[model samples]
Target: MSIFQIKQKTSGAVLWTGSAHDEKTALDAMAREAGYADYASLPDQIRAGGVQAAKLDLIS
Candidate 1:
C-alpha cells in the first residue's frame, strides 16, 4: 500500500491524506473527503479543478 495525498487544484490545499491500495481507492478517499457520496457524485468542476490525488512513497 502507499500513502495518497489529495489536494485542491486551484488553491493547492491539502484535502485528504491516507493510505490506499490503488488509484480507485485513492479517488474514493478524495471524494469522501470532499463530502460527496462517491467519485461520480462530484461535480465536473470539482473533478477537474477542485481536487487531485497523487501516490506518495510506499508505507513500510
Candidate 2:
C-alpha cells in the first residue's frame, strides 16, 4: 500500500493521513473516517470537490 494524505480541498486542512493501495481506496477511506457509509454516500462537497487525496513521498 502507498501512503496518502487526505485534505479538505477548499480550505486545504488535513483530514486524514494513512495508507491505501490507490487513490480510489484512499477516497473511500476518507469517507469512512468522515462517518459516511461509503464514498457514494459522501456529500457533494466531498465527492465532487470538497475533499482531495494525494500520494506522499516519504523521506528515507
Candidate 3:
C-alpha cells in the first residue's frame, strides 16, 4: 500500500487523498471526480457509452 493524493490543477488544493496499491486505484478517484461514477460503472460507461467523451464535449 502507498499514499496517493489527487489535487485540482488550477486551485492547487488537495481534492482527494488516500492509499492505494497502484495507479489503477488512483484513476478510480479521477473517474469519480469527473462524474461520481463508482468503480464498475465508470469503466463500463467509458467503454460503451462514452461518458467521459460526452462530458468533455459538453457546451456548457
Candidate 4:
C-alpha cells in the first residue's frame, strides 16, 4: 500500500504517518518523490540503502 512521509533534509531519516510494508520501501518512496523525475538513477540508492540527505533538494 501507499504511504505518506516527512524526512529531514539533512539526515536522510524518514518519518511516515501511513502504513508501509517495510522501512526500505518507505525510504525508497521518500527519495523518489523528494528527488522527482530526474531520479532516473534513484532506485539504485535503494540497492545500497536510501539516499543521503546531501543528495536531496538538488536544483540541478
Candidate 5:
C-alpha cells in the first residue's frame, strides 16, 4: 500500500491521509469523505500531493 495526502486547494490544508493500493483509489476515497460529488471533481476542491509510507503520527 501507498500513503497519499489530500489537501484543500484554496487553504492548502491537509484534509485526509490513508493507504491504498493505488493513487486513484486513495484520491477517490478522500474526495468522497470531503463531500465532493465525484472523484473527477476532486481536483477543483483538493490537491493530491506526494505519496509516502503510512506514518504513525501525521499531524504535528
Candidate 6:
C-alpha cells in the first residue's frame, strides 16, 4: 500500500490522508463516505469552487 493525501484544491487544507492500494480507490472511498455520488463527481464539485475540495498527493 501507499500513503496518499487528499487536500482542498483551493485552500490546500488537508482533508483525508491514509494508505491504499491505489489512488482511485482511495478517492472513491472517501467520496462515498462523505456522501458524494461517485469519484468522478468529486472533481466536478471541486471545479464549482467550494462544492467540495479536490487535490491528491502521493506521500509514499
What number of clashing residue pairs does each candidate have, in the order they appear? 0, 1, 0, 0, 0, 0
> In angstroms, how far off is 40's CA in candidate 6?
1.9
CA RMSD of all predictions: 2.3, 1.6, 12.0, 10.7, 5.6, 4.7
Ranking by lDDT: 2, 1, 6, 5, 3, 4
lDDT of 6 at 41: 68
State the lDDT of candidate 2 residue by residue for 32-55, as single tens digits. 987987778887755566777899
Q: Best TM-score goes to which candidate?
A: 2
Looking at model 1, report the run of 10 residues with the lowest lDDT sum. Answer: 50-59
lDDT of 1 by residue, 1-60 (tens): 888888888999887889989767888877887788888888887777867788887656
| Clash pairs for candidate 4 | none
Top-lDDT candidate index = 2
The lDDT values for all models are 0.82, 0.84, 0.51, 0.47, 0.61, 0.63
Q: Candidate 6, residues 33-60: lDDT per residue as tens digits?
A: 6788766766665635542323345455
Candidate 2 wrong stretches, greater than 4 Å: none
Error of 5 at 40 (Å): 2.0
lDDT of 6 at 33: 68
- RMSD of candidate 1 to the truth, in angstroms, is 2.3
lDDT of 3: 0.51
lDDT score for candidate 1 against the true structure: 0.82
Compute each candidate's TM-score over C-alphas: 0.70, 0.80, 0.45, 0.32, 0.51, 0.57
TM-score of 5: 0.51
Q: In model 3, where is the ten-residue run with the lowest total lDDT? A: 49-58
In model 1, what lDDT does residue 6 have?
84
Give lDDT tens digits, candidate 5, residues 1-60: 666776655566676788767767776777688687657765632345532323334465
Using alpha carbons, what is the TM-score of model 1? 0.70
User: In candidate 1, which residue ranges exceed 4 Å CA deviation?
Assistant: 58-60
